[model samples]
Target: MLQIFSVTFPFFALVLCGYLAARRRMLPLEAIPGLNGFVLFFALPCMLYRFGASTPIAQLLDYSVFLVWMFCGLVMVGFTIAVTLNDRIRWNDASFGALVAAFPNTGFMGVPLLVALLGPLAAAPIIVGMLVDMVITTSLCIALSRLDGADKHGMAVALKNALRGMLTNPMPWAILLGGLASYVQLELPGPVHKTVGLLADAASPVALFTIGAVLARSQILTVESKHAPIPLRDYVPVAVFKLLLHPLLVLLVGVGAVQLGVPLSRFALTVMVLAAALPSASNVSLLAERFGADNGRIARIILVSTAVAFLSFSGAVGLMT
Candidate 1:
């Protein structure tokens, strides 16, 4: 357990540092976007690209893992939606609720943390999980939200916009370019490669700190303030699904796939499970707000899940190791 803490403490410590800095106004909240821009547009992409470029293309393209992860995620999403609907939650809000329950923070939190925990090879499964989230989970949620009358754009248009957004995201493109380089055996110039290495190296710490700052800005801990408190009944279910059920389903699906002769490594299965065990994506609240859903509820879900994740994630790492 001490060994597990040794491995896991630094990641959450960085987050705590950022949270305290933001909470105490030691770090300007305005600076978070710029830091996030650096991670999303530059540092993270460089890291992923290097990972993709160096790894065998076959390892990078594990379709069975992708399928199983997506299937399990969809099952969770559907279950959430159904439960919310039974409670007479409005469709738009319920769709967003399902999303918050199902989507993991795979990019900012999962990639760097998993790389630190499991090594750079872990990035492959994380990337695959990201793609599944972007292409299938997010698109489905957006489409459902539209069908629920959140947008006048219609379901088809909403889905199209989701796909378009995914395509334009720098992360997927970085992965593709890296895979292409590996496929064609193209070597980057030494200087360029060195520069990318430097940027890639910056990804983990900055991303982790930014996560803390973002959490602080969300002010999720300040339930006694002006914001209305989230109903426990509503929040607990989503939190349970995101932090517990999602990972359990992913593990079961992964193990079943391995039994069926899927070429998934034990390490890859571990990565998938760890990724699923992550907290809900912080941006789901923003999406909830955008779609005119219950943003406060979603924000609270993100906060509770993130706060509780330290124990859950550390346990996952210890169990896997």
Candidate 2:
């Protein structure tokens, strides 16, 4: 239908543009890392700040819905393993697996898609979800990964790292400052707002273009053909958990919360689930490489789960809309 195309085409168009640019060598592979940094630290934070500041704090701070959804994701891990053919992975791999399953591509894909299909009011819930994602889910992943590797630093270190990461994160700061400003009824200065708006506007298209460049750099086709054989079985459980189980868990939590008199919009519920259903962040590979985790396996997990999430996400949309 034209409605669906109106919603879906822009996303794919960005992807297509990025892919074509890479194929044409208009953007070098090496520029992607720096471009990603700009998107993540500068553009993304500016966008989140604006989004959070613009949203009503009461709606964004819905503890009931947030907790229920978070709990459901926490519990679903074991259930996923029981239902699927999973391996006995070490902590690093398990940490990566759980996060890939739980943390969707909310920043790059979910926000833009929601803006198109759902509209402006929907941005509030998307921003709230993004806040939770940056502050909680990511920190948890990093802590658990370190724990998985037998780091004896205890909870203190984990908490410290998490907070430090949050403090260092420009987007979280934006959200905080914006929320405070909103609470105090301060209006954004016109010229400052305009400058941020321009930079934030570039976030989605440029980020997606960078993702395309990264994917092209991976040379998936060649790897698929020439690498030592990968056990397709290894990926099956990760895909199942990330693509199918996680979204369902979020939906179940949403329905339960709604039934229990939690004040959440159906639209908010939809955004939360879509956020859960997005593929793993592209940075998973980058982090794995830097940390000496199993980067190869992690890359495969990212690729397979992302490839499958398209269908999974379409299903979520059908249920929600």
Candidate 3:
């Protein structure tokens, strides 16, 4: 566990640099979107392409565990709706609430931490999990946010919109293309591989820094002083769902996998649990803004849950590892 700590600490430190830089105005909030674009569209995709393509297909197939994790996410979504169904917070806010409750910071936080602790083998499961997340969790949040408006589109339109969003997402596309390339045995030449590697190396540092910048610029805390109720109560259930229930569910699944003879290593299991315990994606707040939901509360949840997740992740490592 202590050895794991040695590896994990540097990742958190990068997050801290981003947080502190933004908090101190060393990087303006306005720069975050562009930074995000670069990470999402370029760095992450390149990294995914390079790594995902190289991983063996048979190793990537963790059908039982994947099903379990997806089930956990679905259960959390249902749980969120039940908890947030009140006049105090509308249904639209509930959708964002569900998203906050269910979506882990699997991209920025999950990938780097996994790579650091578990080595290259962790790439396959993380990529698989990410595909599940983007296709399901993200789509639901967007569709639900639209429910609060008068523009009631049909189910087909909502489905189409969600599919489009997923299809066009550069990060997912990169992973998909990389997987195809790997499957087809399309190896890149040495110089191109080196170039992609260089860009990929920049991903973790840049992403963490951008998260800090986004958090710094977030308006969540400021809404507290306003006359509106600010959805304080809504945060309670969502945070509990994320920081406490989510990890427990993952742990249970891991234990079951162990019992059923799943071939995951200690390191791989550790990555899965840690990824599960991470806070809601920092992107959720931006997503809330895009869909006309409660952005401020979403931001606060991201910040608070991130702080909680550090402890949660460390504790999980101590107990499981």
Candidate 4:
């Protein structure tokens, strides 16, 4: 466990560094979005593209891994909603809360961190999981968020909006282009490849830092005196679901797949489990804010899960390794 902590501490420490930087005005609050934009648009897409282009097409499109992870995500969305829904908590809150529980921080944190711990092969499962969350889990949750809304189209409108968001996102397109490049045995010009390589290399540190800064910005924005003090019930349950339940479901389902002769590699299974074990994606709060959900509660859940993940995620890695 101590050894595992040695591996994990720097990652979490970077997160803390971002938090403190934004909190202290070292990185101005206004600049957080720009930093996040650079990461989302340029750094992360290039990183994913490189991974997708380099990985074998078969593994890149590993349907079994996709199905197992997707099933677990589906279960998480329903289970979390079942437990957390109430008079005070409606569809939007529960649905987004469910999203946090199911969608790990794979892009920003999981890919690089898990690869460091597990090696290069870990990228495939992590990337597949990232795609699953971004393409399907997130879209479904967003649609669900509007199922009870007064908008005449309700879920249909939300679904269209989700598809629009997915289309506009560069990450998936990068993955697609990379896959096509891999399929055609295409390579970029030396200078262009080097440029993408540089951006890919920048993805890890900048992304992790951006996550912390985003968290700090969320914390700062939600600290208004007018808002009611948060209770444990509002955020802790969802945090527990994200940090514990999500990964556990992945592990159990993965093992079942193996026992059923699904040919899922143990290493891939481990990667998927750890990927699921990742803290809630930091960006979910932004979605909550955009969709008019309770951003404070969402941010609190992210902060709690992330803080605890350092210990919980490291311990899981120690045991699994």
Q: Each model's C-alpha lDDT?
A: 0.82, 0.68, 0.76, 0.90
On lDDT, who's better, 1 or 2? 1
The residue ranges of model 2 lying beyond 4 angstroms of the native Cα positions read: 19-25, 76-88, 148-162, 218-228
Writing each residue's lDDT as its tens digit, candidate 2 over 1-321 gives: 456655666675676576567666687767667888988888877877777777778866777656766676566544533343235556655666666666667777677777777776677666666666667766776666675544566656766866886788776677778777767767878998898899889888887776666655554433644756557765567777777777778888788888989887787787777777777766666655544455566667766765565566666666677
The worst-scoring run of ten residues by lDDT in candidate 3 lies at 219-228
Runs of candidate 4 with Cα error greater than 4 angstroms are: 150-153
lDDT of 1 by residue, 161-194 (tens): 7778788789889988988888998899999999
Instruction: List the candidate numbers ranked by TM-score, top first.
Output: 4, 1, 3, 2
Q: Write the per-residue lDDT of candidate 4 for residues 26-77, one digit (tens) a residue.
A: 9999999999999999999999999888888888889889999999999999
Q: For model 1, give the 10-residue run with minimal summed lDDT.
A: 220-229
Q: In model 2, how large is the Cα lDDT of residue 176?
A: 75
The lowest-lDDT stretch of 10 consecutive residues in candidate 4 is 147-156
95, model 3: CA deviation in Å? 1.3
Give candidate 4's error at residue 46 in angstroms. 0.6
| Candidate 1: residue 116 lDDT (0-100) | 78
Which prediction has the highest lDDT against the true structure? 4
TM-score for all models, in order of appearance: 0.92, 0.85, 0.89, 0.97
